[model samples]
Target: MPKLPAELRGRGGPDALMAAVGRFSDLMTPLLGLTARGRRPAGPVDRSLQVVVTSVRAEADGVVSVRLADLAGRPLPGWQPGCHLDVHLPSGRVRQYSLCGDPRDRTAYRIAVRLIEDGGGGSREVHALAEGRRLTVSPPRNAFPLAVTARHVFVAGGIGITPILPMVQAAARRGADWHLLYLGRTAAALPFLDELAPHGDRVTVRTDDLGGPPSAALLPDVTGATVHACGPAPLIGLVRDAVRGRALSFHSERFTPAPVVGGRPFEVRLARQNVTVHVPAGRTALDAIRDAVPDVAYSCRQGFCGTCRVRVLGGEPDHRDNALTDDERRSEMMICVSRATGLDLTLDL
Candidate 1:
């Protein structure tokens, strides 16, 4: 942000200043107008932006739906389950929320947010805001994505339900076999149960005290199915243990910084540049590459968006990315969460 002279900040200053500003605006209008008229500039922004709030709905206790309009009244980049958007809230802070409602709605994105007790005023302000408050938001980005597998078992704990909701819906829509295990503290505490019950035998709902531990017995049947679990750390850890031998991918999003994963310093050779990045203890391969070499590009460093997918032209990848499938792991790798299993990793940078 640039600072303005206190005197020149607001007042419709001198007539000269007004004329100059108007002239600048008028001059740029034609350039934009030309592009708008379908005359593309050599370098033009390919993406279109539209600010619109088409509708609002109360889905659960604190969850609400705010419909956004895509450009030219068409759908924007459709997202899979576990996708989120960075919303510039009415409170002027950017908060990310997972898509919670139906995934088939091509016209708009349905996101649900729970009001937090001490969560930095963002969700609270959103709770109080009524329909029709326009806001700027980024395109959807996925942090947890569904893999292409023969079968799947989706597990969600409490509010962690947002991301998996869409995946199960997608599976159900496809008539593909899937089971959803949703656990919350209480029936009332679980917002979407009413909408979830119809899932019949395919859906399991459990609410119990921590001391009474939810059963992990259902996991052995988890064979031949991709196990997708999202929830609090403890629950996720438990699920991970239960699904030990299965081909599974675990993706977790921490609301806050978490202790680093334990790993040793490994060597990674970027074939193109002949650069070797050293993965330090507790550091990921992506971290090593960026810290040791700065020019590499990456985004959605969590490994779900495919933005950081790179080739392991040589050595085996100690795959940790949340999005890679058994097939994908054999090919591209996500440097963000993966580690080098061998002495040296040759990357196709």
Candidate 2:
């Protein structure tokens, strides 16, 4: 038997390696079969890559930036300004972090995490990572893509600046008219201020400690510029309200899952566990299921990462996630952001 690399050994030893190989074989079965021709399969497939953390540095109060590179020193995949990586932690917890480093630098990818002491343990796990720590991450996925417009207005709040930083850099390189409104609860909590120094006056720094709180008046004139905002829901809402009835285009991404809009109460039956979970209006099925199944996996509850996808054995699904394709929607649904259209749904669990 050939020796497997350390990165491929995984925590489950040989058994895990064989299981992974089996999954890969299954994924390729259709492609190699004569009836399939050369067409690829529908829906997403796991193409996670192993990387070693080369550097970790504190970017601000309770925030740190980590740099990861391929274990074999090979160039990683190229990503756009708004792209993010689904990082799998050693504890089997998955989390999404925006790719903040320069796209031209393919040797390594940078991601920042802010400590959320009271929230899930993902950020805490990331903060504990040290140099040379190994991690598996999904290929870069972009939910918020920057448009190729002449003028751009960016609004960033706290850690939300991670994705906006790369967009601002891209806009400057293109010689497009751009300005950034970087807001934080306090100046000390903001990360990557040094990186934005080159942009000079084009960047606006406003902290709640210094200036009460951000309002529509603080927003720059977005008349002809495309507005890109990412931050707390309130900040994004302010920008959305400001841009309403205007001639400009608006895009925004949230750090948290969007509030359930027009949601109706529904019940989800876990077939394997023989249990049923009730999802109330304004609450996600993921949350309700976790009450019965504590170890359910999920990341980026915003519905773009596809980590919480479950097989729909019966009932109609009100698919609201962006990760799944039409083919996937037929049999599977993302339980994090998507819900049932009817009163009940049966899940594979």
Q: Over the stretch 120-176, how does candidate 2's per-residue lDDT look in tens digits?
A: 789999999999999999889899999889999999999999999999999999999
Model 1 deviation from native, Cα RMSD in Å: 14.8
TM-score versus the correct structure, for each prediction? 0.59, 0.86
Report backbone clashes per prediction.
0, 0
Residue pairs clashing in model 2 are none
Give the TM-score comparing model 2 with the true structure, all chains together.
Answer: 0.86
- Could you tell me which 10 consecutive residues in candidate 1 have the lowest summed lDDT? 1-10
TM for candidate 1 is 0.59
lDDT of each: 0.70, 0.91
Q: Against the true structure, whose TM-score is highest?
A: 2
